[model samples]
Target: MAGLITCLSVPFLSYLGLRSLPAQETAPRTIVNLEVIVVDTESKALEALERLKKGEKFSTVAAQMSIDPNAGNGGYVGEAEVASLRPELRAAVESLQP
Candidate 1:
């Protein structure tokens, strides 16, 4: 019947239209297992980074300088999927190499 064809065609056309839409880009994601030493000021954070570049032990610097609660735990935040993080943080984490 005409009514049946029309109903079926509507859904088929709708499906085609939806399928033609461009796919959205998904953000990059990765598992991360790393330590961080959080400092209160940018200057202090830079200093910490410098220390790391010079091969200072991460746990020692974290214990001495980090303001994060996890400092006592040697700044271990454990594993996390970068995509599950907030947008800015996810982007930052994705830019880094292992």
Candidate 2:
């Protein structure tokens, strides 16, 4: 009776674990260079966006406007996984051409 109950429980437990996972079965795996500019306020974020639109060097803009500790390193975030990124950033990355 114990062996029969154990076999029945295993499949149910597996199904529950699978259901708890993210719905996005396959996250983007390719690595891409990402430029980031983190600012303290909405106004600052707008300013950084304007700089990017003007074709300013991303690293230079990042160094000047970003308050992040790694601002000096040109804001190079290196390769990243889409699943690990915030929703906004993930959308940006998804828009890029492969």
Best by lDDT: 1
Overall lDDT per candidate, in order of appearance: 0.78, 0.76
Off by over 4 Å in 2: 1-28
Candidate 1 local lDDT, 1-98, one digit each (tens): 35542211112247447433333443456688767788889999999999889999899889889999889978988998876888888888778876
Please, what is the TM-score per model?
Answer: 0.61, 0.60
lDDT at position 82, candidate 1: 70
- Candidate 2 residue-wise lDDT at 73: 84
Error of 1 at 5 (Å): 33
What tens digits encode model 2's per-residue C-alpha lDDT throughout 1-98? 35542211112237447333334344447666776788999999999999889999989999999988769988876777676788988898888887
Backbone clash pairs for candidate 2 read none
| Colliding pairs, model 1 | none
